[model samples]
Target: MKLLTCPLNGQRNITEFTYGGEYHPMPDHQQASSREWAEHVFFHDNNAGIVIEWWCHSASSYWFLAQRNTISDKILRTFPADEIFNQRVDFAPAPEVSSEAAPTTKGESC
Candidate 1:
């Protein structure tokens, strides 16, 4: 059976982990347009070289990052997510529209 090391739990069966996705740095949320956001969320480079990716220890719910070779399908190393994402990405809720501006909210009383 294949094995994968968890930065927090040490070596474990690969079955215990979940492949999150490619660990690409997020785009500037404040400056990125809707199209850019769509592309970032939906697209993957699928590069053949070594790339950092997000992985989770399913049993413990511990998430981490791993460096893997796409062509070889081998994980080189694994580390905590905080090592790369030092800051959290918060999506601010859209401003609520007033009754005067939105027809849907005019008579809908909940």
Candidate 2:
């Protein structure tokens, strides 16, 4: 099974995750025709390069964006849940922080 990392916890697992979609946004509802809407909702772009995606951590009940290299299983970066729907590509890897930035021993760290 494909596993996603919780942007909050950093640990890799399945139960704590969900695949929202590749980070491409669709046109506004008012601007798109029915056919365009259908295509946007059902079709897959699957761009073969770096992709940003939303991963909802159900177990932790948090949402976040993850940047991953589609050609490789490498997770490039992750950001706060609220930043998922934003039209920003500045979501690159963060500066390596020491243990201070590590997930606190609060949640299940999954």
Candidate 3:
């Protein structure tokens, strides 16, 4: 079994944690069209590197940010989920991709 280290606590088993998808800005549903909706549901960039993903500490009722090593399923770094959440982030949100830019998968949604 893999291990999960909580930023607030310490090393905890992986069973106590859950994987959350990549962090991105929520698109405005009202202004989004059918194509935009489809893109949002299916088109996500699978970038490899240190990405800040959400980790729910089911055993502790807490959330934290994890620097996930996507290639190996190994965690590089972790900290109190709120450390990144509470900070004044100035990062540009993901680009609004067109539906045509999405992959040609059969019926899977990202």
Candidate 4:
């Protein structure tokens, strides 16, 4: 069995934690369209590369962030969510696109 290091609980069985999906910037609901909101709610990149994700320690009910590489399944580091955000990075509002700039297709083009 694999182990995942929790920021608050130290290293523990992977089963002791829950995968909370990739971390993403929350978009402004007032400016976001139905499609943008739906995409944010239902979609994930699932890319085969390093990604920052949210994880919860089931035993302590503590939530934190983990930076891991999906291809190697290796966790690089773990930290409390607030610690990561304490850097004061600004989350800018999503850029507005005109209808002419909107994609005509239903899905991403290869």
Candidate 5:
């Protein structure tokens, strides 16, 4: 079984945590268009590369950010959610995909 190191609890079973979706900046809801809001709420890159994501410890309900590789499923580092922007990992902005180029299915041909 895989183990995830919790910033507060140390190493623990991966099952003790919940996969909270990729972490991204939120646009101002009041000023954002319907498309922007929808994109923020519904779209995910799910790229087969390293990405930052939110994770919550099921037992303690502690939330944190994790820089993990999607293809290898390896977590490079973990930190508190508040450090998302100030983190020293130097994360680049997620690339935007035009609606015309977005993938539609799990196994659909590109």
Candidate 6:
């Protein structure tokens, strides 16, 4: 049986982990176009080489990252997600509508 080491939980059965997908730098959400968004969400290289990916420990429900070799299907290492994403990301809030712009009723009410 194969084993995978969780940075927090130590080494455990491979079945105890779930593969989260290959890691890629995210495009600027505010600046990226619709096509860019779609590509980031839908496209993957699936290259045959060492790549970093996201993984989760099932029992703890803890998420982390892992580096593996696609050709050999070998897991090289694993670490917490915060190691790479040390900074926090904040999104701009949606614009508020004005009272004058409130929607009009479609039918007569009592």
Best by TM-score: 1
Query: Looking at model 3, which ten-residue stretch has the lowest summed lDDT?
Result: 83-92
Assess every candidate by TM-score. 0.82, 0.60, 0.57, 0.71, 0.71, 0.82
TM-score of 1: 0.82
TM-score of structure candidate 6 = 0.82
Decoy 5 TM-score against native: 0.71
Query: Per-residue lDDT tens digits of candidate 5, residues 12-90?
Result: 9999999999987887655789899899989998888999999999999998889999898889999877665564443
Query: Across residues 6-103, which tens digit of lDDT does each residue of candidate 2 receive?
Result: 65777766766777887667667556798998887888788887888777887777878888898986778788856645564443476798997786
The TM-score between candidate 2 and the true structure equals: 0.60
Q: Candidate 3: which stretches are off by over 4 Å? A: 25-43, 87-110
How many steric overlaps does candidate 2 have?
A: 1
Model 3 lDDT tens row, 1-110: 78888877788888888877775554676577889878777777778876767788887777878888788877888887555456454545778989999768788687
Q: How far is candidate 1 from the true structure (C-alpha RMSD, Å)?
A: 3.5
Query: Per-residue CA lDDT of candidate 6, range 6-110, in tens?
Result: 999999999999988999888897899989989998898899999999899999999999999999989998989998898887889989999889887879588
Where does candidate 6 stray beyond 4 Å? Answer: 94-110
Better of 2 and 6 by TM-score: 6
- The better-scoring model by lDDT among 3 and 4 is 4
Q: List where candidate 2 sits over 4 angstroms from the true fold.
A: 1-5, 10-15, 84-110
- In model 6, the clashing pairs are none
Cα displacement (angstroms), candidate 4, residue 27, comes to 0.9
> Residue 55 of candidate 3: its Cα lDDT?
82
Candidate ranking (lDDT, best to worst): 6, 1, 4, 5, 3, 2
Instruction: Tell me model 3's lDDT, rounded to 2 decimals.
Output: 0.76
